[model samples]
Target chain A: MRVLVQEALFDAGAELNAFAKGDTDIGAVVSFTGVTRDVSGGLSRMLIEHYPGMTERALTQICEEAQTRWSLADVLVIHRFGTMEPGDNIMMVATASRHRADAFAAAEFLMDYLKSRAPFWKKEITADGSEWVAAKDSDEDALDRWS
Target chain B: MIDVLYFAWVRERIGIPKEKLETTATTVMDLVEELRAREERYALAFSDLSALRVAVDQDLSDFDAPLSGAREVAFFPPMTGG
Candidate 1:
C-alpha cells in the first residue's frame, strides 16, 4: 500500500528499501523516520491518539497533494498509533522520484504538512505525571515558510 | 443531525469518542455552548475554549465559523502533531 497507518511499529530501513526497489527511473529516494526518545525523566511511554475514519482521509489527502506538487514516482507513509515505549519507531515517510530535487522537496513537504496539519495528538508521560503536549510555535512557523 | 467526535484528553473528559446530536447551530461556537450547558462533564471538557481546537468535515477550522451544512465536527485538545 502507498499509505499505511497502523497501531504496530515497523523497521524503517527494511520498509523503505523494500518499497523503492526495481524502479529503474527512480533515481532518488528520500525518507524520514521519527523515533521515540529515551529520556531519563519521562514516564516511559507516549500515547498517540487519532480519529479513525478522518485519519486515513487526511493522510490520503496530504499524500495526494504532495504527489501533485512534485513529480514523484511513489510515496509511502507509515504512522503508528496507541501507546508506545521509548526508542520505538513512531512514523516514516519516503518519496521516490526520477531526480533528487523532487524526492527531497516532496519528503520535506510531507513532514511539514504532517506536523502542522495531521490530526494526531500526543501525550508525554513523565515520571511524576502525564501531560498533553501542545502544538509548537516552531511547527506552525515551519508551515508558514511553505505558504 | 451531526456526528461529533472527541479525541485525547477531550475524549477523557467528555466520556465518549463520538456522539450524534441534533442541533440547529449556525456556528461551531453555538454548538460548543450547547454542549457546555448540557452537563458538568461537557462543561469541563469545554471549560477553556482556547485550549480546544476543532475540525469541520475533517479539515481543521476555527470555532467561529458557521456550521450550517456540516455533517461532522470534531473537538480535541490543541494538536501536538509532528
Candidate 2:
C-alpha cells in the first residue's frame, strides 16, 4: 500500500502502469482519477487546502479500511494539494486484487470515503471571485451505500 | 498548550492558519466557546457549527469530543475531497 499527499502534478497513466507492473498474482487492477472541474463557465483555477498531518492520516485509514473489507493485493492513493486549473488531475486511486469484483468494489469504496472523510477543501476561482466549494448532500449520502 | 488550526474559510475568517494557546476547556465545544468569546472574528467563524467540522489529534471527531490529552485541534468545513 502506498499513499502520497503532494502538491506536484502526477501522470495518471504512468502511475497506473507502475502500479500494475510485474504483479503475476493479481488478476484485476482498477484505477480512478479525479480531475478539477469547471462547474461554472468562468472557472479559472482551484485552490485546494488541506490539514497537512490529518490529510495523510485520514487517507491512509480509508485505504486500510478498504483492504480489510476486500481481498486486495495492493492499493495506491495519490492526492494533490495547492493550486490547479480546471481539467488538471487532482487525485487517483488504484486497487489490485485477485478478481475484478474485489478490485472494483474496493476502488468505489475508497472513492466514497475519500470524498467526505479526507481533510481537503477546494476553492474555485473564477472571473468574478473565489468561493469555497460546498460539500454536497449527495456525497455524504454516497457513503451510506458502503455501510 | 494546545495547537489550534483552521482551514479554508475558517482560516480566512480567523486571519491565521494555526496557533498555540493555553486553555482550560475540556471538550472541543468548550474550546470553541472560549475562542468565540475572544474576538468577533472567532465568533463569526464559529457562529454556525452546522457548517463546520472538528478534529482532535488529526482524527475526525465530534464537537463534544474530549480534549483532555489532545495536542492538536482543527476546525474546518465539511471535506470536499475527491
Candidate 3:
C-alpha cells in the first residue's frame, strides 16, 4: 500500500529508496517536490488550510485520475497542511511504472491536478497583514499542457 | 439546509468561517445570489464571482452547477495552498 497522505517528516531519498527496493521490474520513478517559499514578501511562515476529509478525498481522486490516464504501477502523494517555514517541503508526488514515459507523464499529471484541483489553501503572513495568495496563471498554464 | 464554509479572503470579507444556510436553490449560483442579498458584507465578499471558486461536497464545481443534494458548500478564493 503506497502512502497517500501524512502529516510528518518526509524524507525524499528514503521514499524513493523504499519505493524501488527489490522491485527490479520497475524501471522509472518520477517525483516532484513542492516547498514553502521563504520570501513571498510575507511573514516568515505560511499558514495552510484544508477541509479535513475533503482534502484527502480530492487528492486521492486526482491521483486516481492520473492513474486512469496513464499506466502507473504505483502512486504516492504526500501533502502537509499547517504552519510551514521557508524551505519546508510542502508536498510531494512520486509515480512509478515499468517505462520512463509513463512514470514521467503520471508525475506531471498528478502535479497539474494538484495545482489546479486540490482543496488546500495557503495564506502568507506578511508584515502588513496576513494575506491569501491567489492561484498563479503559470499553474493554470502548467495544467494546460496535458489537456 | 447545508453547511457553508468560507476560507481565506472570503472569510475575511464575510467575517466568518462556517454557517448553516437553508435554501431551496439547486445551483451554486443561486446560493451566491442569496448570500449576496443578505448584507453588505456578503455582497462585498461575493461581489466578484470571477474571483471566487465553489466546491460542492468538497469537489470543485462551477457556480452554475446544480446542488440538489449537496450536504456542504464552500466558498474560497482560488486555491493558493501547495
Candidate 4:
C-alpha cells in the first residue's frame, strides 16, 4: 500500500501500470482519477489547501481502512494540492485484488471516503474572484453506505 | 496555553491560521463559546456551529469532546476533497 500527498503532478497511466505489474496473484486492477472541473465555465484555477500537519496521516488511515475491508493485494492513493488550472488531475486511487468485485468496490469506497473525510479544502478561482467550495450533503450521505 | 488552529474561510474570518490561547474551558464547545465572546471576528466565524467541524490533536472529534490534555484544537468547515 502507498499513500502520497504531494504538489507535483503524476502520470496516472504509469502509476496504474506499475501497480499492476508487481503482483501476479492479483487478477484485476481498478483505478479512478479526479480532475478539476469548471462547472461555471470561467474558472482560472483551483487552489487546493490541505492541513500541512494532518494530511498524510489522514490519507494513510483511509488507505489502511480500505486495505482492512477488502482483499486487496495492493492499494495506491495519490492526492495533489496547490494551485492548478482546470482539467488538472487532482487525485487518483488504484486497487488491485484477486477478483474484480473486490477491486472495484474498494476503489469506489476509497473515492467516497476521500471526497468528504479527507482534511483538504478547495477554492475555485474564477475571473471575478475566488471562493471556497462548500461541502455537499450528498457526499456525507454517500459515506453512510460504507458504515 | 492551548494551540488553536483554523482552516479555509474560518482562518480567513478569524484573521489568523493559528494562535495560542489560555482558557479554562473544559470541552470544545466551551472553548468555542469563550472565543466567540472575545471579538467580532471570532463571533462571526463561529456564528453557526452546524457548518463547522472540530479536531482535537489532529483527530476528528465532536464539540462535546473534552479538551483536557489536548495540546491542539482545530476548527474548520466540512472538508471538500476527493
Instruction: Identify the candidate with maximal DockQ.
Output: 2
Candidate 2: tens digits of C-alpha lDDT, residues B17-73: 999999999999999999999999999999999999999999999999999999999
How does residue B70 of candidate 3 score in lDDT?
96
True contacts kept of 1: 0.67
Which stretches of model 1 miss by more than 4 angstroms? none
How would the docking of model 4 be graded? Answer: high
Once fitted onto the true fold, the runs of candidate 3 whose alpha carbons sit more than 4 angstroms away are A1-3, A40-43
Give the per-residue lDDT digits (tens) of candidate 3, residues B29-71: 9999999999999999999998999989988899999999999
A1-147 per-residue lDDT for model 1 (tens digits): 287879987989899879878889899999999987755455579899887777777788989999888998999999888988988899999999999999999889989888767888988887887877778878878777667
lDDT at A46, model 4: 96
Superposed Cα deviation of residue A146, candidate 3 (Å): 1.6
lDDT of each: 0.87, 0.96, 0.83, 0.92
What stretches of model 4 exceed 4 Å from their correct place? Answer: none
Q: All models, DockQ values?
A: 0.71, 0.96, 0.67, 0.87
- lDDT score, residue A109, model 2? 98
- RMSD values for the candidates in order, in angstroms, are 1.8, 0.7, 1.9, 0.9
Better of 2 and 4 by TM-score: 2
How would you encode candidate 3's per-residue C-alpha lDDT over A1-147 as one tens digit per residue? 253555665887787767756777888889888988766555688888877777788888887888888888888888888888878888888988899999998888888878767778888887777877779989878877787
Every model: iRMSD: 1.4, 0.4, 1.3, 0.8
- Candidate 2 chain A lDDT trough over 10 residues, lowest sum: A14-23
Error of 4 at A57 (Å): 1.3
